[model samples]
Target: MLYQITADGLVLFHLSFILFVLFGGLLVLKWRHLVWWHPPAALWGMAVEFFHLPCPLTDWENHLRHRAGQAGYDGGFIEHYVWPIIYPAGLTPGIQLGLGCVVLLINVLVYLRLWKWRRTD
Candidate 1:
């Protein structure tokens, strides 16, 4: 029970991190200081998708789930959770690369906006 709750919290935190990695630049537009935080996160996010790196959060979640006597899921958290909601088909390598590219593009645009805004100020 405790393990399950912790695992659930981990999932929530993982999702929050993913969202931040994608859109934290928008937040940084307001906070400004988050500029330092977002780039590394965005880079890590891109690397994870582009290289198929195994995230420790997923592993810890799976470990907790197994501890709670639940069957752990295969694949990364996005494949298990987010992919189904976004697309009907399974995530292919090409799709994964595209996703990474999308992240890169979005962050690039966000940073460009930030740069332009700073120049004006």
Candidate 2:
């Protein structure tokens, strides 16, 4: 029971990190020091999607679930959680590419805004 709860908590943290990677640039707009942190996370996030790499968070959660006598899920965090809700179709390379591109586009737009804002100030 404890392991299950911890696994669930990890899932929430993993999801929050994903959201931060996607939108952290906006946060940087408000808090400039976040600029140091967001790039690495955003880059890693994009690399995972673009390169079809597995997220360690998913592996850790699955491990915890198994330890708790629950059936572990296959694939990454997004696959088991976010993808099913957002895309009814099975995940594919094209879909991953699209996801990566979306991340890239969001970061680019946000950073451009930041750049302009800094220039004006």
lDDT by residue (tens digit), candidate 2, 66-104: 999999998889988998999888899998999999999
lDDT accuracy of residue 25 in candidate 1: 92
Model 1 TM-score (2 dp)? 0.96
Runs in model 2 deviating more than 4 A are none
What lDDT does the true structure give each of the candidates? Answer: 0.94, 0.95
- Steric collisions counted per model: 0, 0
Task: Compute the lDDT for candidate 2.
Answer: 0.95
Which window of ten consecutive residues has the lowest lDDT sum in model 2?
A: 86-95
